[model samples]
Target: MLAETARPTAAPPTPPRLGFLRGWDTAIIAAVLVSILVASLTVEGFASPRNTGFLLIDMIPILLLALPMTLIILTGEIDLSVASIAGFISCLFGALWSSGLPLETIIPLCLLLGAVSGAVNGFLVSVVGLPSLAVTIGTLALYRGLAFVVLGDQAVTSFPRAITTALQAKIGATGIPVWIIPVLLLALVFGVVLHFTGFGRSLFAIGYSEDAARFAGITVARTKFWLFVASGAIAALVGIWWTLRYGSARGDNATGLELSVIAAVLLGGVSIFGGKGNLPGVIAGVALLAILRNALQLASVPEDTLSMLTGGLLIAAVVAPNAIVWGRTLRRKPHTT
Candidate 1:
C-alpha cells in the first residue's frame, strides 16, 4: 500500500495594518493646518493677534462641549439636549443671581441642575431602554422650553467685572485666552482616559456591539448614564463660561450650539453611526470649523451662508466616510470575482 500525499493547511489571513499618518485623524489634522495657512494668506485680519484671541475665546464653548460629546458618540449614542442644557443652566444662573445668591453658590447649583437634567435623559434612554435619539430629541425641546420658563426673554448683564475680565484675559504676548490652559488640560485628561483606559476600550466595544459587550460583563446602562451626566455637567460649565465671557446670562445663551458641536464631531472624522473616532481628530475638527467660521466672517460672509455651510459639512461628514468604504468594497468585489 502507498502512503497518501499530505495537503498543507492554509495560513490565517493577517489583518491590515494602518500606516502612520494614513488615518482619518491624520487627514483632519493636516486639513486644519492647511486651512490656517490658507486663511492667513487670503483672509484679511484672520491672523491678527486681536482676531486670533477672539477666535480662541469663541472656540471655548464648542471645545469644552465636544470633549464629552466625543465619548457619548463613541458609545453609539447622541445627545441633542446638550446645547439646551447649557442654555437652561445659563438661565438658571441668572435667576439665582437675581434672587441674591452669591456667584459661588449659584454656579454649583446650576451645575447640579444640569446634572439632574441629564439624568432625566439618562433614565429614559438607558434605564427605560428608549432610543437615545428620540430621548435626547424630546429633552432638547423640554430643556429649551424650561429655559424660557426660568428667565423669560430678559438677559442678565450684571456679573462681576473681575471674573468676566479674567475669563477673557489673554496670556502675555501670545494672544491666547487664559482660560485655554484649563480647557487644554481637561482635553488631555479626556484623551488619556479614552485612549489608554479599560473603560475607554469598553466604550468602543459597546459601540461596536452592545450585546457582546454586555456578555463580556460591561455595565452598559451604568456607563451610558454616567456619560449623559458628564455631558450635562460639561454643558453647564460651558454655560457658565459663556455667560461670563460675554458678561451676560440669558435663556438664549448657546441656543443652536448643539448643531455646531455635532457638526464638529462628525467633521473631525468621528462616525455619526459611532464606534470609531479619536480625540485628536475631534479637536482638529473643532479648530477647522472655528478657523473657517472666523475667516469667513472676516471675508464678509453672511451669517445665513455660514449656517448653510455648516449644515452642508455635517451632511458630508456622515456621507463621505460610508461612501468611501462602499466604493472600496465595490472595487475589491470585482477583483475577487
Candidate 2:
C-alpha cells in the first residue's frame, strides 16, 4: 500500500472576540442605566413624567450640536467655535426679527450666516493649512464678540406665542416634547450616514492617516470644509430651537455650551485623538450628563458645583480611555525568557 501522505492539519479558527462587550460605548450605556436607577431611587419625583419631559427637553440642544460635532472629531479635527456660532446666529435671529423680517425669511438667513461662519473656519483650517484647534478657537472669540455687537446685552423675548408653544408642546401624556420626534429623525439620518455610508468610512480613514486617505482618493480638504459647514448649519438649527424653547434670544445664548457638547462627545467614547465613536453612545452620553445634572439640581446642588463636576468628568473621560489602552498594550507585550 502506498504510504498515505499526511494532510497538514488546518489551524483552528480563532474565536471571535467579544469586542462589543468590551467597547467603551457599552460601558457608557451601562453607566447611563445605573445612573438612572440610582437617581430615580434616591431623588424624590425624579421618575415623574413632568420631570422626564423637562430632562429630555433640556437634552435637545446638546444632542443636536453633539451630532455634527461627532463627525468633525472623527476626522481628527475639532470645532471650538460651535457654541459661539449658535450664540451668534441666535443674536442675529433676534436682530432680524426686531427689524421686522418674516420668521420664515429670518430662519433661512440665520442658517446661511451659520454656513458662512463655518466656511470661514473651514477655509482657514482646510485651505490655509492652519490647525483646526487654533482656527476654531479664534473664530470662537470672534463670533462671540460679534454676537454682543449684534444684540448687545438686550434679550428679545417677543417671539410668537403659537410658535413657542408648538416648540414646547408634548406628545399626549408622555411628557416628552413634540420636538424630540424631529430631533430623533435627524439623529437617525446622522446614524445612517455615519455607520452605513462610504463618506463615513472615508472620515475614519482620514482620521487614521490623512496622507493614506488622500492617496486612496478622498478629498480631504473639501470633506473637512463641508464637515464644518454642516456643523455650523446644525448649530444654527440648535440656536433656533433654543431661542424658541426658552422664549428668549440673547447675545449670550448657549454661552459655554461647548463644554457640555465636547464633554458629552468624549464621554460617549469618541477619542479626542479621533477616528472612533458611534451615535448611540453619544446619545447615551448626553442622557447621562443631563440626568446627572437634573438629579443633582433636584438634590440642591449649586451651579458652581455642577460646573466643577462637569470639568472633572471631562478630564476623566479623556484620561480613562488612554489609560485603558495603555494597560492593554502592556498586557499584550511578549514576555522575556
Candidate 3:
C-alpha cells in the first residue's frame, strides 16, 4: 500500500534584523546631533555659516589623514607616523618652493617622500616582523626630526597662488570650504574600496587573524606593506593641502595630532585589536571630533581643557563596547537546570 507521506514542516523564518547601523554608528550619530545642538545653544556665532566654513577648513587635514589610517588600523596595524610624515611633507613642499622647484615637481616629490617613509615602516613591520606599535613609534620621531632638519624653525609662505587659493576658498558662496570636497571624495572612495573589494576583505581577515589569513592564501605582508604606503601617500597629500590653506609650512605643523587621528579612527569603532570598523564610522568620528572641538572653542574653553575632553572621549569610546558586552554576559540568566 502506498502510504501517504507526511508533509514536511518548513523551518521557521528568521526574524527581520536591524541593519548595519550598530551601537558605534548610533553613538556617532548621537554625538553629531548633540554637538550641533550644544554649539547652537552655547555660542552666538557658532551656528553661523562662516564659523562652519572655518571648521570645515580645519577638519579637512585630519579627516583626509584618517581615511587610510582607518584601513591600516582595520588590518590590526597602526601608523603613528602620519602626523610626522605630514609635517615632513609640508616642509618639503616649502623648501622646494623656495628653491625654485616647479609646483609640479614639488607636488610629486612630497608624495614620493611619503611613500618612501611608509615603505620603510612596512618593511620593518612586515618583513622584519617587528611590532607595529614599536616600529611606528620609532618612525614618528624619525620623521618629525627629519622635518626639523629640513626646515629648521623656518616657515615657507610663498606658494603657487592657484594651490593656495583652491585650498582657502569657499565653495560656491555656501561657506562650505573647498577643502571639504576632497575629504568627502576620499571618504566615498574609502567606503567603496573597503566594502566592495576582495582586498578589503583580505585586510579585515588579516586583522582578525594573521595566521588564518595566511593559511587562506592571502599575501599578508604585501597587503599590509601597501597599506602603510597608502597611508603615507595620503598623509602627504593632506599636508600639501593644509600648507596651502594656511599659507605657511613649518616643520612643527600638526605636531601632537597623531593622538587625534588615532582617536578618530578608534572612535569610529575600529578596535585597537583590529578586525573591526568601516569608512563611514571613521568619517563620522572625524566629524564628531571636529564639531565637538569647534563647539568647545566657541564656548571659550581652555585648550588644555579641550585636550582633556578629547582624551576622555577617546577612552570612553574604546571602553564602552567592552563594558556593554560584559554587562550583557552578567545579566544573561543561566538556563534552567
Please give the clash total of every predicted structure, in order. 0, 0, 0
TM-score of each: 0.93, 0.93, 0.91
Instruction: Give the alpha carbon lDDT tens digit for every residue of 43-158 in model 1.
Output: 98889888989999989899999999998897889899999999999988888888999987988998998889888888887899888888899999999999999889999888
Best by lDDT: 2
lDDT of 2 by residue, 147-260 (tens): 999989999999999999898788899888888888899998998888777887778777766766778788999999999999999888888888888888898999989999
Candidate 3: C-alpha lDDT: 0.81
Local accuracy by lDDT, each model: 0.84, 0.86, 0.81
lDDT for model 2 = 0.86
RMSD of 1: 8.0
Residue pairs clashing in model 3 are none
Off by over 4 Å in 3: 1-19, 160-162, 333-337
| Clash pairs (backbone) in predicted model 1 | none
CA RMSD per model (angstroms): 8.0, 9.0, 9.0
Candidate 2 local lDDT, residue 268: 89
Candidate 2 Cα outliers beyond 4 Å, as residue runs = 1-21
Which candidate, 1 or 2, has the higher lDDT?
A: 2
